[model samples]
Target: MLLLLPVLPTPEFWITLGNYVGLYSIVAIGLVLLTGVGGMTSFGQAAFVGLGAYSTAYLTTQFGLSPWFCLLVGLVITMASAYV
Candidate 1:
């Protein structure tokens, strides 16, 4: 079932699928917090998510860094961007 899906799809497909799911889940959680809890609708959450993805891609590709390390840097970058 769930375990068989990765075998059926190409590695690239799974990687892309995983990225989209992760991005969407983060956005959804942000939206829930912003709109449901704060009672506000703002597009800034999407920008922060994009900032994170951009930093992750840039760091990983440009510097050939570890994906895990790049992702952590991206998270910090995103938080700092939002704070600024």
Candidate 2:
């Protein structure tokens, strides 16, 4: 199945598919780290991701922040919240 990804007809579809796969792989790695290495059950992973997403969305939409600034702000907020 993975070998057939490049055979997709539309280049745009392939790009979108690859983007999703990359995002899911990141989430899976995070989950594995939390559950396996940290010995912790982290059902709140989605919540943390959602919080960061909302923070970035709000900063970009409401304040017209640059993507890099929004990303930095989102990461800071997410890490602070997790630490607390």
Candidate 3:
């Protein structure tokens, strides 16, 4: 990435890849906590991540809502879904 600093206009793709890697790292942590500690496997963490991401993306793009407000909304949606 550093090598492309002068050759490329910007490293947007690398930045996006880094974001996805970070997101999946959290997923891995969640899986280890649940499977190793509880002795069971589940994809709940990834599901919640997708739910929150979709909710926030939709709200922000369609309604032009503030990211912070959309974040709160997404959290609420995810928690409600998790509870039920």
RMSD of each: 2.9, 4.7, 4.5
Residue by residue across 1-84, what tens digits does model 2's lDDT show?
A: 767767867578778888789868988899989999999997899899888878988999999889679978998999999999
Sorted by TM-score (best first), the order is 1, 2, 3
Model 1 stretches with alpha carbons more than 4 Å out:
1-16
Show where candidate 2 strays beyond 4 Å: 1-19
Q: After superposition, how far is residue 26 of candidate 1 from its true place, in Å?
A: 1.4
Q: Candidate 3, residues 1-84: lDDT per residue as tens digits?
A: 767765867678877787789868977787888899988978777799899989999999999999779989999999999999
* Estimated TM-score for each candidate: 0.72, 0.66, 0.64
The alpha-carbon lDDT assigned to residue 62 of candidate 3 equals: 99
* Cand. 1 Cα-lDDT: 0.89
Backbone clash pairs for candidate 2 read: none
Residue pairs of candidate 3 with colliding backbone atoms: none
Q: Give the runs in model 3 whose Cα sits over 4 Å from its true position.
A: 1-18
User: Predictions ranked by lDDT, top down?
Assistant: 1, 2, 3
Evaluation by TM-score, superior candidate among 2 and 3: 2
